[model samples]
Target: MNLFELNQAYRELEERDDLDLETLKDTLDAIEGAREVKLDSLASWIEKNKMQIDWVTEKVKDLQAKKASLTNLNKSLQGYMTQSLDDAGIKELQTKNHILKPRNYKASVVVDSLDDLPEEFKQTKTEVTADKKELYKVLKDGQEVPGVHLKPNRGTVIK
Candidate 1:
């Protein structure tokens, strides 16, 4: 059934006193051919595995590039937001935060991008994304866009 069994059987037949030299030579050739086929199969399997590994490596590189791109974009956006928020009352529009009598409001730097959005923004996306209810736009009132909370609420007071 297996190579060893087949080899053992072949050997037993070859040791028969009447066995001819031609027959022995033919059997040895056949066994060598079988070994070649097995080796070819192993080579093919290694080639396929190598291809798979190469493909996965390229995929990992592409993902890393995408991550780097996003990081660069976030750094750019954050720097812009900080400068904009600082000069908002005179240059850019201002973000409005309201503290009801019992609550004191504080305005902190926040972003709603792919990576750095707050847990509150991620959880209540419907409230944050609606047109009139954005989470982080500078306002005119300083305009309060519904329920969005900004940090450092005490910017240049609106009069």
Candidate 2:
């Protein structure tokens, strides 16, 4: 209600000579008590909502950090795996098994035996054929066959 309406209502109540003073005081007290109850209820509602808001906020932050860590871990693993494939000569295995004869060898040995390999078998190419006549000749001449050189994990250097 507008201020004028409220003022009029108060004036009317005050001018009511029929109502006893005790009854008027009791009614005013009841209105004040109701206002207090409403305020208290509103405070409780805010408190409850705050608990949920705090919990959700914490969970969101934790998830964000975990996501970042997972992403970094994935990238690190990808890089490590690529290095492993390169070191292990995975490409040579695939090409040799699919297109070349079964001369079981590692990448380093295959690279060193480049002279013995046929033009096609030196690496992997479309026009490649392996003629191991030279490789066998060298071995037959008592020269050690060129193979993958594997040293002990920890040992004296042997040149």
Residues 77-116 of candidate 1 have per-residue lDDT tens digits of: 8777656555554334434763212222497765547467
Per-candidate TM-score against the hidden true structure: 0.35, 0.34
Model 2 stretches with alpha carbons more than 4 Å out: 1-33, 92-159
TM-score for candidate 1, residues paired by index = 0.35
* Model 1 pairs whose backbones collide: 94-139, 107-150, 107-151, 107-152, 107-153, 108-151, 108-152, 139-143, 140-143
The 10 consecutive residues of candidate 2 with the worst lDDT sum are 96-105
